[model samples]
Target chain A: MKEHKKLPSAVIKRMPRYYRYLTTLQQMGISRISSRDLGNRMGVTASQVRHDFFSFGASGLQGYGYDVDLLRQEIRDIFGLDDLFSVIIIGAGNLGHALAKYSGFEKNGYKIAAIFDVKPEIIGERINDIEIIHLDKLQEYVQDNHVDIAALTVPEIRVLEVAKLVTDNGIKALWNFSPIELLASDDIVVENIQMIDSLMVLGYNLRTAEAKLNPN
Target chain B: MKEHKKLPSAVIKRMPRYYRYLTTLQQMGISRISSRDLGNRMGVTASQVRHDFFSFGASGLQGYGYDVDLLRQEIRDIFGLDDLFSVIIIGAGNLGHALAKYSGFEKNGYKIAAIFDVKPEIIGERINDIEIIHLDKLQEYVQDNHVDIAALTVPEIRVLEVAKLVTDNGIKALWNFSPIELLASDDIVVENIQMIDSLMVLGYNLRTAEAKLNPN
Candidate 1:
């Protein structure tokens, strides 16, 4: 990144949104997109989009707007998507299996290096051609293979224990699917996603909208 | 609630975290917790926790702090979690099947009404006892059954088409897993989970943290 200042977490979070939308535009063969049009599609104001772009030193011509391909490339680079990361899924349950088969991560610079599970039945199994190895081999594999991230889809009770194993083995980040909230050191980053929390947000919003529609 | 003003989106987003933590505390048999302790567990400041509670008209005692059960109940009520939302998965893909089998939703207000897909092969299949029905039956099922949310795990190309079908059928909220963003009307809420975006965030953070640890 040319910009010396560290971007805020919120801004960093929105970078992938821009990357996704811009990639779509690029695929559709749209050569250019104005801040206004991009913001409209992204559900943000034009000035907000311009300001966000400025944070990453992405500039647009006064009348012409941003070049679609260049802008997408810039955002992708900003996200460190240019670098490939070897990822390991820590659990071989349904969620883990689904994530293992998800092709989106490979498309966006994440390569599934291995999958670890305690279950002997699934340990040697393969999901979408990615082998599920025993958890005993996790630390050794991570150390030897230089795994970048551990995506934990283990049950809530096993989160802390499994997290310790991954973090101890030099995993710099965690995409946690378990409901348990993890405490990370300054060098380690944890993105704890409680899927139910998201569902609750949806439920709450749905209720409010329902109320507005029929206030009985 | 009692506060006539609608809660801000940021506050609404935090409600689930609060609910989750409090529920954990409640399960641990911890009946009372001060804002400071709660904040410590939640990675926020005591004052910030207090402020968030106040946003929903939840007040902590001067010294005794908040009642864990009471606080959890209040947040649950705020999230409108007392009621159940009938949910349907739009695609019968791996992710969709995983979500269908995920028991967390039923434990927290979201009940899987059914799973829908265009594929004829999987139409009669079942995931966690929920039937996978034809996508053509979605509109009629939703209309007659009153589905509160549609969890879209469809392919990128089919997202817009499937989203329109659900939204038009009065599905109030969408938990979209597809990479493509959905445009929702004012009355409908869309929680777009770009899983790749989250993975990118983890990658970016990892790179930055790695740089800090071993600077070149």
Candidate 2:
């Protein structure tokens, strides 16, 4: 119950994937999962699953494995997601709007607290209950709401500039959708999403699987 | 080069990461880089770099290292990105739009051939030269343009449905940004872009670094 205990970001990251898999099992009305079963979801070995789960002090039993609901709660607590994070949206572009009204945000203990955009065309528009504020109002919003994390869906050319604006306003983390890398001070963490690298992997994997099947 | 000559998928996956590191060196005007430098960028041992590079036919001088530009080109060619890939975007949501208009996509030989959306609201919208078309029109576009790969950025609830539509339309590979597990047939491959997992790893590394700095 310690207030400021930090989960290793890597552990925090895997928590979501694990959460996704567990959610699938939960949807199927499954009550228990061996670490191997969890690993099978991501094409990883069961030992790898046990090792990853060990980092969070929850390990599947040798015979009984893990109680799906209990493991999910333990992870939720470790990731500081037991309470919803007040997440603001920066850059009310298509990406920002989709994200602001995204279904997954609420599911993962995140609230789209505010939406910001510099464009006059979209400044006052609302996505769901959240209104789109001008980017000029970012500092005020961040300070007033004590915003801790933001989703940067801005133009790649301005990703760093906007990142500075977000971090300077006392934000500690960001879910960056910008293609370019955002260089941040050690205090603030930024995650870049690369689409092509992902696509290439899928293509290569498919090709590899086909090759394996037809080894002539 | 033979079109169907399949490289190891693991090699293909890591190529971009190594390429990014080399590109960093190129930006710094570092003409040559040692395998150790690549290893450091990847958080792997220098010997591991030597081992992987050997597989790639990087039989360079024992003392010196790889030419950064040359190695970069080789990596690009190995990943089959020396030429542009005809790519498409499925789901005109936040992640999809960000991907369609991403500069990194252009930089990496991925050209957005089309964008598909099921929502009637987005069907006529445009991201760069790519116009969003309804899912009903996807097969036409894929057959006409021969879009080699598709990126799935739909929500979890719609991920499987959209993936099925894309693959059914002849998209042999998919880059899934949705935070859900996809069941791909043997003929198609799906790779989930788990950004949270990567960020978690970064977070864990940061924690380890912090622990080393402030060991109690």
Candidate 3:
């Protein structure tokens, strides 16, 4: 893989969105797209889209727009999506099961290698062909398998412990779904899915919109 | 509710984190917190914390710090959490079922009034006491009940149609979980939970970190 220039955090955040749009365009049999059309679809200004692409050295021809496949491949490389990652779910609850069965991650190069649970009854149960193993075996599993990310879906009380267990065994990335935030060392990367926070933001927006309309 | 000064988008984004941390402090029986302490816990600078609070007219005493309960309540009011919102899930698949069974949203004042699905087999199914109704009944249900938000968990192919169905019936807020973006009118508030984007960001971070460590 070529070493790419470090992008601004704001630009890095939008890379995924650009990739998604480019993929959709590809699916619709679009071989190339002008910045104006792409920006229109993404709800951004054409100049803004050009600026973002230019920041990453992806430039369109003077008159002929960008080649969609090349731009998407560049984004895929930036996200390291070409590399497959082995993932383990730390809990087997409803959320965990949902994630295990979710094919999106697998399609995006992250595979759920196994699931761990403390419950004896469900220790051997299978979710979408992936076996649920005992939590006691997490250490052994990580040691044997090349695990890349540990998706923490344990209950709030057990989240910290499960995170510690995964990191202690050399897993460096954590995708946390529990409500609590995971404080990991500098070497570890943690991404939290704060569903309630998003919902709260939505609620706040709705309230403000209503207030604007009513004002009483 | 008192009228609040409009906050910067950055501050508004941090409000939920502050609320979560404050709730944790309250649970731990801490009635007051200095900006320094709060900032340290939230991984931000004390001045930044104070600036955010000051922007919202929440000031702490020079020596006594801020009252945690009062601060929390102010945030709650800002987020309009005091008002219970009627949320209907639009899909009854794994992710939908997980959201229905998850008790966090209910505890946070967003009630799942009902679940809607097109499948006849699971139409009358109950997830955590909330019945799954057919999608055909969505219009009548929204007409009768005060539906505040529609949680769209349907497949990508059906997202736009479902979004139109809800918004056409006067729903204003959408908490979208599908991978597609919903293009709604100016009046509608859409909050997208892009799980893949987050995972991709994490992957990019992990790759960059690995590159730094290897330096080959």
Candidate 4:
């Protein structure tokens, strides 16, 4: 992989959505798609979709538009999806259990290696054949395995501590599910999955819709 | 609530992040903050922060900058965070159970009224005093209660059917946690929380960083 200028954060955030939609189109046996149709499906303007693809250096044939399979494969390569990314969950709680059993991540190149927890009752258990190990063993496990991502599903209070442990032990990326934001240094990439934030946005949009309907 | 012109979806998406960071500032007893400092904390440029605030019609004092509490409250209001939003989860699976137990959503005005599941084994169980009801009763329950949001944590295969049932009974907004994207008509608002998308972004970012480091 050769180094290129870093893409803007907004553009990086949208790449996965494009990848997902392109894959959907491919699955439907749609071999080609115009930006207009793709934008319609994604709720964005055709120009917006074109601008996004521009960031990826991807273009369409003037008349035929994009080749769905080739476009999806190119985006997949940009995401480094061809490489298997071994992941470990740092909590064995409900969310952790669900993520371990989620087949979607596995399909997208993230393989669940194991789940780690501090709870004695959960330490010896397994979810979807991924064994749960005590938190104390996480550092050693990372040292021995090619762990690429650590899904931090631990509580907020313990996030900084757990994050420090994971990053210190060679895990360079985090899928943080904690309520509090985790501060990452230059070397680490942290994607904060704030569930409450998503719900709040839904609340705001729903209220806005009601205001439009009732005008009160 | 009066209807103003609709804001851009990109600006709407950034509101929760602003709200979360402002709340964190308020909690720390920080009285004032400049756009630059806020940008430093949020990993964006000062100009970007100012642009975002400009969208909200919020301006900082020439020298003193933004009053932390006031800015936070204003953003909170923009998000309609003061209103109580009753929500129901469509699945009583592990993710649904976890969301029902997450107190963060309750703190932000989204209340979990009940969880709906077709599985008899989970139907009677409760998480954080929110009972799981049979899926057959969801429509009736929505009619009787003021349900504003449906947290769709069901499997991807069942999403469309479940979404239709809830929306037909008056669920206008969805906090979807399913892997597949949900298609929403004009009357419905769907916030698709694709967990796998987040992970893939992290993987892409991590690989990009590695490419920068090794240049191979």
Interface RMSD of each: 1.9, 3.8, 1.5, 1.4
Better of 1 and 4 by TM-score: 4
Residue-level lDDT of model 3, residues B113-165, one tens digit each, is: 99999999988989999999999998899878999999998888899988989
Q: Per-residue lDDT of B16-88 in model 1, one digit per residue for the tens? A: 8888888889889999999999998888899989898898788989989999998887877777666777888
In model 3, state the lDDT of residue B156. Answer: 81
Instruction: Report the number of the highest-TM-score candidate.
Output: 4
lDDT of each: 0.83, 0.71, 0.88, 0.85
DockQ, all candidates in order: 0.66, 0.43, 0.68, 0.76
Error of 3 at B75 (Å): 1.0
lDDT of 2 by residue, B1-216 (tens): 123455555666666667777887899999886777767666678887777667777655667788888878777666667567777777776667766766676667768888888888878888887888888987777667767778777777887787777777777777777766676666777777765455443343334444545667
| Ordered list by lDDT, greatest first | 3, 4, 1, 2
Q: Report, for candidate 3, the interface RMSD.
A: 1.5
Candidate order by decreasing DockQ: 4, 3, 1, 2
Which parts of model 4 are misplaced by more than 4 Å? A1-5, B1-5
Instruction: Give each prediction's root-mean-square deviation over alpha carbons.
Output: 2.4, 3.8, 2.3, 1.6
lDDT of 4 by residue, B75-165 (tens): 7777777777788888988898888878798777677889889988877888899898998997688768888888898988998888888
TM-scores for every predicted model: 0.92, 0.84, 0.92, 0.96
Q: What is the per-residue lDDT of model 4 for residues A113-140, given as tens digits with 9 covering 90 to 100?
A: 9999998888788799999999999878
Docking class of 3: medium
- Per-residue lDDT, model 4, residue B93, is 83
- Using DockQ, give the best candidate's number: 4
Clash number for each model: 0, 6, 0, 0
Specify the highest-lDDT model's number.
3
